[model samples]
Target: MHPQPESGTGTTAGLPATADGRTSSAPPSGPAPAGAPDDGRMTWYVYLAIVISTFGGLIFGYDTGVAGGAAGFVADDYGLSSFMEGVVVSTSLFGGMVGAMAGGPLGDRYGRRPVLLLSGLLFTAGALISAFAPGLAVLLAARVVLGAGVGAASVLVPVYIAELAPARIRGALVSGYQLLTTLGIVLAYGVNALFGAGQAWRWSLGLAAVPGLLLAGGVLLVPESPRWLVSRGRLEAARDLLRRVRGRHDVEAELHEIRAVHRQEARAGSGGWRELNASWVRPMVLVGVLVAFFANGCGINLVIYFAPQILQSAGMGSSSSLLATVGLGAVNVVFTVVGMALVDRVGRKPLLLAGAVGMTVTLGALAVVVSVPGLPGANWLSFACLSLYIVMYAVSPGLVAYVVISEIFPLHVRAKATGVATFVIFATNLVIGLTSLPMLDRLGTATTFCLFTAVCVLFVLFCLRMPETKGRTLEELEARFRAAADSRAHARVSRGV
Candidate 1:
């Protein structure tokens, strides 16, 4: 009973029903009609949906980066020490781990939309609580809540985007999640620099509620994942929804493909942690978790969670330091877009190798520059190396790690394994975010960067053992992993201790 439009884009005028009880305005005939063109063109509505959904990534960036500028102010206001500084910074991540574990089940059991709505609610509540908190305890508690929301958002957003998009554009649309992530960071840096002098830390923390509200409101207009609908046996509804998001022919074709995969998964019966414990599952999980671990562990968060502080330690004032942090956000955004363009052109593994080598070199140079001063413009060296590190990160692990997490596992154990992997990622982020200040104070920049450089070298060796995933479908990737697992299992049985 919705109102008709004067512009002629109405549901009755050929818009097809979708899985989530909504409809797309595209023809019901689906994407192709047989031997038609398969150029993988997308409608404007697809782009619009991506924009709204990736707001989840925006919140992630804002929450993580805002603290760098506000941490000193909050610490001074609440009389906190370095340990407390780390705790406050990392509290949200702890909540994120909790949320991630919860999100996977919720997303699978219910749908992406409901879990996303819950995440929005958590974000709103956390922002309000943190803004009004009177003590370190309250602030930390509030951050935990916020982190929970962030974690849920992180998992759901990309899953949602990937599910809805066509394969040809899937990487690009998912890459939008990373792009929006950079936008959030840039926005946070600007806001922090603008209000660094005032009681603006309150504003910084509280303003996060704005995006949460927007996401809640925006999601109302999105269609459910057509694949999730098929999994639930809502074929008619799925087909109708597909008609709107995709063309008539594309809808029918995609429905067949999704149904085939779902049927295969159902027959295989492998969607839980127990299934993951089977012989073929262990190594992939190990690789996924370690990739996530080292990606976060090797100084990425140390730089991100403590950028402003690092600049201050290198001798800039708090205000100037906050301003300088914006540069990091800029570099991240620029290089991420570049990296996204290069993903298909250059492939994933090569990018990681390049990023690792670049990270090691830049980090080593940074350590040397910090230690050996008085050689004319040595201070510029610190900022330059930091910028290079940011660029290296944007192009490699920072970009690929999440994509790998999403693609690596088989469908049966995808949610649980990813949840566990994401938990490890959050846990590592918490450790780095919390202990970084004490580490910085005790270790100094020279030693810290040197340690990080060594870590990067280890990452390069680890990545060498990882397989390439360029241009691989989810089903193809799963098949290869299953074969590898079965082979390993056969070996284990033969050894029989």
Candidate 2:
């Protein structure tokens, strides 16, 4: 049913496919051959798309991080109880969960670009409402509105980059979303420190509007995802966009590869939720969901949203705690750069395994340091441990999780599948955000961190089961996963499970 490509064309020779759909050989790197036109590396338009779309990430980071410091002032301003504080802080994540669930179907139906543009508008409106909200209820409503944009951007931005980037630099390019997220968080921390003492949480919460407006306006200038265009049977449009992004490369071969895979899926009736019931589809979706869930379950958001509170508990003053949070933000941004640099060369799995081990050790150490009473330099020790934890997280799971989730699914269901995975992420985030303050108040800091440490240990085991996706084309990765999924299904039938 699928159209065949011309012989000796389409896919390159070195990256061979196995009986299972995975690529058997490593993808080629660096410049193209001597006779080739350009290296097919990044072009101006590609850079533009990446920069513009990732502003959504900036909004994601700012809105999420601003709440950390803003929550204290908000509590003061509204006389919020601990329970109410948690409610206010977590309402956005609930909205994010809703947005993520909707993003996939909407993005798949319309396109990645329109969904992104809509996210920017939602983000802008939410920020303004949050900044100007007169009461706790209004603030909560505004947070939910803002959160929807964050959730949609979370699913759509990485998918956009992954779909657009050339295979050679795809890992690095996709990681840009995470990198910008950290940068936005760092910006929020700086803003929080500047305003923490002045009853200026309104400024901190509302500053997100600037980036939201920028993103909303900027996305209009970029092209839509070539893959999305092809999926809609807009062959010429897909070709033109691919040429713009990829430049002098052989567009026909790439187009054929995309079309061939899409055609195969079409014949197999593989779209929407019903197709997910197929045995092969289930594993990929499961892996994506687990990866998204565990990324949050490891208690990253606990530190992210409650770093100031965590420091305050460790005997630091409000000013000192806000300053310490800035340090944590700095560490996050710096090590995220480390992740961006190494992801393409060192691969995704190793980084994840390393980060998990490092987080377990750091969180356990932080718990012990904080739990001991009257210990010398305990506050500073906690800061050090927290910084190290941020480094470990930023360098590994923080970045790789987004990249892997974006890369693992087949193209046809990618938007829907990513939406599902992102929903799991936000759901986990909502639970953590809501429970973090209460957990600290009721269970104590040491016990709370020990719980997170345990989750990191579980994550290490999860990483062992994940496939490596670096240095491969989207088409190759899709085939490999399908093959592996089929093989597992056959084995399951053999066992009568």
**The best candidate in terms of lDDT:** 2
TM accuracy, model 1: 0.88
Q: After superposition, how far is residue 230 of candidate 2 from its true place, in Å?
A: 0.6
lDDT of 2: 0.86
Report the lDDT tens digits of candidate 2 across residue range 1-497.
22222223334333444555443322233433344222447889999999999998899888778887788788887898887888888888998998999999899989999999999999899999999998888989989988999899999999999999887788888989998999999999999999877879999988999999989999999999998887886666777787788876466667667767787788677487777666677788888998898888999999999998888888888788888888899899999999999999999999988999999999999999999998888888999999999999999989999999998888888998999999999899889988999899999999999999999999999998888998888888888877987888799999999
Poorest lDDT segment (10 consecutive residues) of candidate 2: 1-10
Q: With candidate 1 superimposed using the best TM-score fit, by how many Å does residue 137's alpha carbon deviate from the native?
A: 2.5
Model 1 Cα shift for residue 432 (angstroms): 0.1
TM-score of candidate 2 relative to the true fold: 0.91
Per-model clash counts, in order, read 23, 3
Cα distance off (Å), candidate 2, residue 217? 0.7
